[model samples]
Target: MSTEVAAEVVVAPPANDAEEGTKQSHKLERKWAFWFDTTKPKQGAAWGSTLKKAYTFDTVEEFWCLYDQIFKPSKLTGNADFHLFKAGVEPKWEDPECANGGKWTVSGSRKTNLDGMWLETLMALIGEQFDEADDICGVVVSARQRGDKLSLWTRNATNEAVQMSIGRKWKEIIDVTDKISYSFHDDAKKDKSSRGRYSV
Candidate 1:
């Protein structure tokens, strides 16, 4: 996506306003924004400069419509990343909503069914399935050469109980028994090879 197409807020027509037999678009608890970062960065490009806000949607129909097109996370290749965050939150470490946050990450390989996991995470997010929804910030799927990765970002890094609960619940949602690790954005900033502060 390009800057010219970014930040387009999409609030679907209300169910009451639809035609006599038209289907309704179910509204989500909160508006969510989609962002995309290209697979390759140009030489000397500014950090996050390649990121595009994409769009913001507050209904089920809009989410599916967009997902089938540009947002098919599994279609992303190379160093590309697809981010889905609460409407006002930027998918960047410096954003106030994410500055002190950390993420619970699950690495994915060739047989990991990345696409299925992506859809499951997206639905859980828009459906507000987490018990600690207040601490949730966003989710990201990074497609890389070594392998793909899915990470659920949270609003606080030091909140151990909340983080653990989230990690456990997410594992259940994605139906994975593999250990998922949580690491702080601050820690990641300091050490690219940083270890997880907690695991579940």
Candidate 2:
């Protein structure tokens, strides 16, 4: 007696160039640059000197690639920071785009999901989800031993209406029930003891 065996073969259809291209490319409204800072600076170096321009991305795909390559907020050592700002805008209070601006800041303990919050904030800025999108300059996440801080920098600190709206939207997007504060760069630079100009 003889036994017969049959084999099944499965094949994938040919790749579609057009569909592949569409899936691979995503254009953002504005180009953005990523910056990194560490507490240990080069001896005698100016504050901005240690700040490094990491990468710039103008597409969704590029952003994800960079994100994957970089360390998340929770993974960073204490005193490390990550900055994401509009292209051509430095992540410094001295920058022309940020001189007159302010930031909305939210602090969380080590237990908090700082990485998730940071990613949400980055997506909101890049996606133009905020009503006052044009007023935004950048976002920053600072990792500290005690806790982590997330901040959204805006162009006009004195613009009460716009700043308030931005703060509200940011809190909502992050889905944090805790109140966040908004303070002017000038105030923050002048006195760490000064309170935020607005809170939501």
Candidate 3:
């Protein structure tokens, strides 16, 4: 009989000792899942199903473990992706949190920036480093043959004030060579986007 191991949906990392020889403190006990896409043929499984759980982490230690085990963005196949989202939050356009959301996009062909940018974006999201932290839903990285794409998803697209705040902060955090583009979910759903606004 061929033994098949069930995929682990999520893994949470444990806490570490403090500098004074005590347990470290965490302001936000948020649970996050780190997903990896290694399936060669993308057509076989849904994006969510193909995702193998590298780990779920609440502490800083496990996050590094998950990050270390995966193939970096620079090493991934063109069609592969690495997604880290809040537990139970699927990295899909149609997800409720993402349905009305928009993404701040950073695109480039440079490999060095691609992987680093992805890591920075993750920090911006989970660390709540951006000014509009409440508006953020999650982050996604698309490692394509043509170019790598990093996008930060927000819960609402119509809130220009919040959207712009997030976009500008994103540019400041990442080594973005050029301006980052903001795309609204509604506008994205339409056949075309109406000269979408970009924060340069």
Candidate 4:
């Protein structure tokens, strides 16, 4: 039996004009699923059971609603991770859409304000700001004891041109001066110490 819960699909209500004549809702370019995972899991529990679908949202208002309800990366202690991916794509590397993909990762110390960075990354993803938007799969933030990590996952590892474009745009969006590295999912799974295929 699987413990994974189905993602909840939320449709943004039709925009309505207020007394001031302004539209009330802003729709996103795509629907996104928010996933949460904690450091602790049941002994002998399947990995999927430990990773749960938290919510799915397609509007700016809904995104804020869900974000407000979830724990911020800074508040998540130990090995916790937050993943925001396209509605149909699971965050795991094995997912068909992500199997051949890679990620561009940026790390910051505990003192860094990761919550803001994560939020900005999400906005960029939903806004389709990347030139290689089609190559994007999602974004993830991992909270660790030593330092935190922010990564943008893309759909093709072999497509260097697409992957690099996404990476460069991501760096610009996040406004980070630090160099970020890109690594294939397969390479990461094989050896954590392996060097990234590209960096910016």
Which lDDT tens digits does candidate 1 get at residues 47-132?
A: 78888777778988778877865676656657888899999999999999899999999987535578888889999999999989
Q: Of 1 and 3, which scores higher on TM-score?
A: 1
Which residues of candidate 3, in runs, are more than 4 Å off? 1-28, 38-54, 192-195
Best by lDDT: 1
Tens-place lDDT digits, model 4, residues 1-200: 11222232223322344435765767898898888776467899766567877777788877876666553677676787889999999998889999999899998654676877888888888888787787889988888877789888888899988887887887887789888889999997888654799998
> Could you tell me the lDDT of residue 81 within candidate 2?
84
Against the correct fold, how does model 1 do in TM-score? Answer: 0.88
Q: In candidate 3, what are the lDDT values of residues 1-200, reduced to their tens digit?
A: 00011132233333355655765655445787766665564576554666655566677656665566552577676766677778777777788878888788887543567777877877666676877676677777777777778777888888888898888888888866576678877786786673455565
Report clashes for each candidate as comma-separated counts: 0, 0, 2, 0
Q: Estimate each model's TM-score.
A: 0.88, 0.85, 0.77, 0.84
Ranking of models by lDDT: 1, 2, 4, 3
The number of the candidate with the highest TM-score is 1
lDDT of each: 0.83, 0.80, 0.68, 0.78
Better of 2 and 4 by lDDT: 2
